[model samples]
Target chain A: MSKELIRLRDLVMEFDGERILDSINLYINDHEFLTLLGPSGCGKTTTLRLIGGFLKATSGEVLFDGQEIGDVPPYKRQVNTVFQRYALFPHLDVFDNIAFGLRVAKVPKAEINERVHEMLGIVGLRGYENRRIDALSGGQQQRVAIARALVNRPKVLLLDEPLGALDLRLRKDMQNELKRIQQALGITFVYVTHDQEEALSMSDTVVVMDKGRIQQIGKPEDIYNEPKNAFVADFIGESNILDGVMLEDYKVRFFGRTFQCVDKGFERNEPVDVVIRPEDIDIVPASEGHLVGTVTAITFKGLNYDIIVEFRGFKWLIQSTDHCAVGSTIGIRLNPEDIHIMHKSEYSGMFGDYSSYSAEYDELTEDAGDEEE
Target chain B: MKKNNAILLSTPYILWMLAFTLIPLGVVAYYAVTDPVTGAFTLDNLAQLRLYMPVLGRSVGYSIVSAIICLLLGYPVAYYIAHRGKVAQKMLYMLVMLPMCMSFLLRTLAWKGLLDDTGIINNFLGLLGLPTLRMVRTPGAVIMGMVYNYLPYMILPLYSTIVKIDRRLIEAAEDLGCTPVQVFQKVTLPLSMPGIFTGITMVFVPAVSTFYISQKLGSADTSLIGDVIERFFKGNNMNLGAALSLVLMVLVFVCTGIMNRFGDDEEGGVVV
Candidate 1:
């Protein structure tokens, strides 16, 4: 098992009596890529800042290697951060920017030059040393920020949405590049982002948070396949969440029909939120379907069509490659493993409905979310 | 059409500059190169500048001292005000500027009142059985007057630039292993160079050429180039006054040019 590098115990952060992080307890294993995934104002970035020693928790302790470092200043910590905006020094060229940390530590001049050049090669900006910050493009500046932080060789690197400003293609490339760098360096990386896909693709462990509380923590597959609540189910991916009652172990009642599911251990006859992922539902013939619905809208995504179907006046988004005409009657099938049952939470009924869904509206909300953080 | 409209809108300012600034400058240049009595072009006025070199040197010395003192005093005040909360920053900035709303001569005269041999301070000291200090009509008094008059210029630009610096840059520096002092030395100080240059120029130019402050605060031994220029003009020696003014303008130009070079070097090269 990997050793723990950093642990936060009962950490609570408050600003003006309003809590931003509520009793957060987590341990980061050495060489693990852990992502704090949530929407804006979800305390993910606040937690990252606490780890970086930029902010002290209002109460509780931040333990680095089993030692309380609550009073340690950011400059004294062995952790660095890549800020959301990159925050490269505008007055310094690329070489000087990457060499800043070494210069501050009074490292030997020849060693500083060697390490900075190695970092430049790692970030793939080999000959852009003399280029000023504003002269570089957004992506190049982002690489400089990463290189600048990584050149310190800190045990833990905190990244707060480092790819948030990049274009789609560059963001994708950098996502993979970050994972490769983390594996090669064998250091802990605590990344924070609101992009669920990025967290799922790049992290070994995903921490889902909301409203200043961690909702769940698990591997990416487990967090996606067996969410702990409606919030996690809805936030991780598109889900059709319906209010349901547990009939017995391995059985649940929804849409006035009892369905077999893989989940158990709930109190018999307990009211629960049932989650069915969009891609998990199979389009079948009406005769063979467990339930029937009417298609209301169809959006042609690149790989599949996002079909919104209305069943008993409730809309559900379904991803299917089959082309079903608008206003046509359709059927969907869910297997025992496809059904996920979560305990009733405060977030129940707040999401999982696509009645008012539109692609443009989703994009608008995502843009607004970016600005809020 | 848009370009024409822009030029048309600037006509009043263009006309004002032509009538006031350009014409006055041309007249000064003309008088500096001409003999007053003969109305003939000659360098006699420029040749006489050597006679007042000591006065010019003293003026340069006093202004440089005042500028340095202002920088040392105003930088901390500017930095403090910039880091304050929004409401407090606004109030402090207004306080810095409040003295400037009054007339410059009145303010210098008020200092004269305070620093006179039997002025309020000395009278108060005498009442307490303390020795009366000599303050007015000294080099210190002149330098103090210049600093007091021009300190707001130093603080205003410094506050603006320091306030505009992104707080993230400071945080980035600290995260990169810099102590608080190093953060200031490596980041905040370099970024504020433009403001420093601007503040020095704003304070030094007026302090160097001011005649009224020296007149109110200095003895004959501390007479500056401005005093000599004023006396020449008052005595109807227009050619000599214009020549001194021309030399003063050149000195200010060279100083600002050197400051701009330092500022540009700090700005770094833009890789087009």
Candidate 2:
């Protein structure tokens, strides 16, 4: 196992008296691919900049190799960045651009030349040493940028949405290529992006953030399979979050039915949020299911069918390979292992009960009628 | 034939150019080749350039020196203005363009008052018990006048181009083991070459052909090619004047061509 290479303790960042990052604590292991995953304005990019030394935190300590690095300049730090737009020098050709850092350090001429050529070959651009930056395609320019940063052999590489500008096919190709390179070099990689699938496929540890705070940090499987809060469940994948009550140990009550569960230690009739993965719900005949519902919509997703069913006025989204006809009654079954429970937060008494919503809607319409009369 | 509306719309400008630009150039060419009084072609007018060779040399030298001085003084100011806040940028623009809005001759005359023997500058120096200095009517004074009048030409274009450079590129360079000074040298300086070329051309072309500034600020010993050309034409020596004018145009073309080659030619011209 790799040891801890970097630690962020009690970090806080503010811009114009408004907080951007609030009291974040994290530890990154050496040779591990750690990803900061969040939506826009969620402080993922701000956290990356703080680590890269481009922006200073309001209060905190950034410890590297068991020592605090207090506002040291970027040039003196042991990290490099691949910017979002692939900020290559337009004035220099590929060779000279890749050789810029080495020349600044006054490296020997022969070594600079050899290392640049090696980088070119590694990036699969052996004959593109003299091409101008604007002449290359987006993917090719991205490779050159990677080569320029990696030629210096920095201790950590910070990539800030480096694949954001590429199309879907090229993005997947580069994602696999980046993982291959990171393993071969065995350097710490701190990647930042809002693409959930990209983070899930590439990261060893995913830190999910929302609104300037970290909600959860775990392995990809743990985050997807067992989220701690409703936000993490909704952000990572398509989740059917419902309002339920824990009747007692190993049992929960929802939709007026009590089902067996593996969770314990909740107060009797404690209100909780239930997370059921779409793929975990199995569709069966009416007599074999615990609850019966009608299919409202069915969409072909090429790999699987995304079907929505309505049971007790609550819509359930299910992903399955079996085909189901719309406007047909169906029964859905859930196993005890598929039901995960968590304490209600931010979204309590607000979901899985359609009777209250219809009641409110009826009240509003009646008020409008009274006003007209 | 096709009835094109664009050709009809451009007819006025075509007539304007033919009447004002091409015809006058043709007349100058005719005068440079033939004697003005006798309708006979001769090379004597072109050969008379030997008489004014020193003035031609001095004109080229002063324009080059003044262009270099404008660059050295204007670059830092342009850089500072480009990096300023929004309110400060607008205020700096007003300050830079305020002098340009006044009449050019009026500004040169104002400089004359400031540089005279008993001018305000000398009076202030006398209060400090310093001896008076002579600055009027010398080559140095002529170059100074040129720089003072044309400094904005260098600053404006440089500002427009430098402001468009992506700030992310500088940050990326700094993240990749580059100090702040190295970031300027490696990224900022090379990217702003288009503005530098335009600024040099803007200052050099007018400085080489100016006679008013030299007459208003310099002594008799600092007679430039413009002074000789003006004298020949105003005194009815049109043939020699036309030849010298053609030579001056050629010299300006060659100097601008060399400067353009030094700029990064891929970048298009900055509008300002």
Candidate 3:
């Protein structure tokens, strides 16, 4: 197991009597890429700021290398941040920007030149040293911001949605580039983002958060395949969550039908939330299905069709390569391992319903999410 | 068509500048080069400027001192106001500008009244058994008057520019391991250069050419170029007065030019 680099113990942050982070306890491993993923207003960025020493927890201890560092200012901490807006100094050229921390430390001139040039090459902007910040495109500016933070040689780097400002194609490319840089440098990275796909694709460990609390923290695969609660299941990916009851070990009842599942350790007849991933469900003939439903809507996503099936009064979105036309009767097959079950929590019945799903509404909520923090 | 419409909309402003600005400048130039009585072109008015060089020097010297003082005083005030809460910022900015609503002459005269011997300040000092000091009709009093009258000009520009600086830039600097003082030196100070230059220009230009403050606050030994120019014009020596005005204008231009040269490398170069 890797050694712990930073730990937040009972960290609570309150602004004007309103709690922003409520007793967040987390430990980041050395050289690991841990991501805090959630929608905006989930205290993910606030948590990142507390670790960066930009914010002080109202009541808790922040430990670095097993030493309490809650009193350390941001400049004294051994970590740096790439701000949400990039925040490159407009007055400085690319070279000076990358050389800022070195210059502040009063590094020797020759070493400053050598290290700045090396960082420029690392960020793939070698010949563009003299370029003004405003002259660069958004992607190029993002590279400069990364280069600026990385040149400080911090023990841990905190990135708060650094790729949030980029377009889709550029964000993907930078996502891979950031992963490569992190692995090559072998430094711990604490990244925060609202983009689930970016978190899943780039993180070794993903922390799902909501309403100022950590909903789940696990490996990316574990987080995706076995969410701890409905909030995590809904936030991580598209899930068809249904209120279910555990009849016995490995047996769950939902849609008034008993289905075999891979989950256990629950009390007999305990109420649980059943999560079935959209892509995991396979469409079959009406007679071959465990339970049948009519297709209420069909959205053609490039690789697959998002078919919303209505069983009785509940709507479930199922992703499949094969298209089922609207008003057609279809059935979904769920393998035992494909079913994920969780104990009911505060977030039960709040998400995973596709009855009101619309692409425009999703985008509207995404835009609203961007304005939160 | 759009460009033509823009030009058409700007025609009135262009006409106003030509009438009140350019034409008046031309008239000044004409008066400065010609003999007053003969209406004949001559360099005699310009040649007479050598006699009053000390007065011109005093004006430049006093204005430079006042501008420097305003900068030292205004920068902190501007930074403080910029960091205030929204309502407090507006209230503080209003307080900075409130004195400007009164007439400039009245404000300077009020200072004269307070600084005079046996005046309000001296009377208060006498009640405390302190010796009366000679403050009125002195160079210090004149500089104080100029600084008092022009401080708001310096602060307004500085506050506007400082407030516009992105707070994230400072956080980014600190995140890059810059201490508080280093953050100001590296980020805040350099970013506020435009405002500094603008404030200097705003304060320096008016302070340099102000006749009322010096006349109201200074003795004969402290009379400035503006006082000289006013005397010449009132004494029916329009040619010499116009020549002095031309020289003062050139001096202000050269000073602002130097300030702009130092400031041009930064983005959003000096506002005025």
Candidate 1 segments exceeding 4 Å error: A359-368, A371-373, B265-272
- Deviation (Å) of B146 in candidate 1: 0.4
TM-score-superior candidate, 1 or 2 = 1
Q: Per the 3 Å backbone cut-off, how many clashing residue pairs does candidate 3 have?
A: 0
How does candidate 3 fare on TM-score? 0.97
Q: Model 1: what is its DockQ?
A: 0.91
lDDT at residue B24 of model 2 (Cα atoms): 95
Per-candidate alpha-carbon RMSD to the true structure: 2.5, 6.2, 1.8
Tens-digit lDDT track of model 1 for A45-77: 999999988888999899999999999999999
* Pairs that collide, model 3: none
Model 2 CAPRI rating: medium
- Please give the ranking of all candidate structures by lDDT, highest first, separated by commas: 1, 3, 2
Tell me the tens digit of each residue's lDDT in model 2 across B48-160.
Answer: 89888889989889998999999999899999999999899989978988889999999899888888788878888899999988988878889999999999989888888
Candidate 2: true interface contacts recovered: 0.78
Q: List the global CA lDDT of all models.
A: 0.91, 0.86, 0.91
Give the worst 10-residue stretch by lDDT in candidate 2 chain A: A364-373
Q: Which stretches of candidate 3 lie over 4 Å from their true place?
A: A359-368, B265-272
Candidate number of the best DockQ: 1
> Better model by TM-score, 1 or 3?
1
Give the better candidate number (2 or 3) by DockQ. 3
TM-score of chain B of 2: 0.93
Q: DockQ each candidate and list the results.
A: 0.91, 0.74, 0.87
